[model samples]
Target: MEYIQTVLFQVPASRLEQASETGGLLAELDGHRAYLKQQPGFRDLRLTRSINNEGNVLIVVETRWADDESLVRYETAEPNVAGIIRKHEDLLVRDSLQVLDMEALRTEASFARLESAEAARSRLVLPLIVPLGVLAFALLAIYGLSRIYLELDKGSAVGLATGVAIGILLIAVYVANNPRMPAWQVGGIFVVVIAALAGGTIWALVQEDEGEATGEPTASASPGASPAGSPAAGGGELALTLGDNFFELAGQKSPTLSVAAGKEATVSLTNTGIAPHNMHVADAGGQYPEAFCNPGGATPCSDPNLIKAGGTATIKINLGAGTYDFRCDFHPLEMTGTLEVQ
Candidate 1:
């Protein structure tokens, strides 16, 4: 095996000029090189200097040999390789002389061969693998977010999609950088963070809705002044009000409209707020059941009437004895109520 010897010494700045004038250091280095070159199996020698932050200069000598036998012969006392070293002892820092021996574990040829093989695999496999990975991540994010979109509003849906995308990216980065991490732990982190983002977003939206509904009256409370649990006159007109975040009936916030079965009723939606809104009435949970209505109207809804402040849209519905849900489709996230058919 090839052997290497490294020698390190610190030379004081005070002696640099004196040593240079006398050519003492250079002559000593030349003598050592000549001796080592003539030795059997000697390969090469290198000398270098480095300056540290403290302005101190470090001298280094590296000698290479073809085999361990040559290195051993130079270190042993029989050859007396200490003559030049003794001459330089006074110029070196106390205890600064250090000698190290190293055996080569790998050669330049071995490194070159390994690097070539790696490069070949990377060129062939990386193009296919990278695109496939990106496609897989995209599909996973879409599938995961879609499962929760129905329960969220438009803003919440977008937020959820963004959160899921970020989470997926983080998982990819984590897995790529930390291959030793347990698979279950990686999945657990992703699930926990994603769920937290979804739940927190939903809760914040609900709180905002409630706060807006309670903070001020955006519409005329008189239109929504109808009492809760009061049965509407059978087939009669029921007054309603649409505001920024409320579906008001008879001047009350979210008043439940009770109407008799097998009758027709008209819900007059008066927009008394800055934002425009329309009323959409469907079965209890927004299931548009096959409830027959007036011609040209599939669901019980008004055209998205851009009712200006104080404008109104009258929606007539054929009421049946069943529970139904009513909401302003334009602001469905916060404007909604229940319709009870007795």
Candidate 2:
């Protein structure tokens, strides 16, 4: 009747293997400490044995909520006190909770050193480190070349190329030292190299797109303009994308989520599988009824529809006081989970 509370005791990735054994560190430490005894709004919590785990076996528990927004915070906030939020969310097994507490009075940096250090180290290693090493060798070679060859002018073509190479190496070192440097931007270097090969393709695409948008013939299209895909959403919105055979959680998926006794919230479905996939929702009870579907199902039923690869779908349903099932009809055992509505 009150706040929905969830407790999860997770292990740092490094100690994962050690935490899986019985009475391991995960059970004794992370799991046990979730409770600051006598803490307000404390409810039932549990510690369980890890199963089918290739990683640490964490202790997980949950409770119910009266306010939808509170549920959101309860799900996200406090758990972040340590790194538990980031560590557990991906590997955690779904443990739904229904709160029975009431009168809940709720109130409301940066150790990015790893990132900076990585940038520092990567600079030292990848660009700076590598180029400096190369430059040292190149400088030695230049000296040797000067000693052995006839024309040893520093302004020669070889000398110019050597200077350019050294300059690029120095810039790489600078980038390695700068955390703001985007290593990926170096990919543009290849774009320049391929410019000749891809010039026509790029130009044709631009002209064709412009022609389509302006309803004109491609042969006589204007100089430069093209209809391009809209830029992606930046903040608080998730854009599911496919790479190879999987999906990436691009941005915030559920920006505004709602839950109530009779109100339904939509589930955003994406197929990240190699094969075509679909999504379906059912009650925690064995109702076997499906809800929300893609280009497949019409309504709630026993079998959910199949969504194709790189596809997406949606579902909305009202839930009352009980636990509900949320799962991919195909990857049932692995992709299945519960949606608790107290």
> Could you say which candidate leads in TM-score?
1
Residues 1-342, model 2: lDDT tens digits:
346455555444555665555665444434544543334444444445443364545545454445655555544555422344344344333442222323345422124555777788877678666778567656654554333222122224366468647967976787788757566765464355344324434543454444344432321221122111222122112223222333233232212222344554444445444344444556456455443344334433222254443344444545565656555554555555444443
RMSD to truth, every model: 15.6, 42.3
Report lDDT (Cα) of residue 48, candidate 2.
52
lDDT, model 2: 0.43
TM-score of each: 0.32, 0.23
Model 2, position 247, has a per-residue lDDT of: 27
The pairs that clash in candidate 1 are 223-251, 224-250, 224-251, 224-252, 225-250, 225-251, 226-250
Candidate 2 stretches greater than 4 Å from native:
1-258, 289-304
Stretches of candidate 1 exceeding 4 Å from the true structure: 21-23, 77-83, 113-342
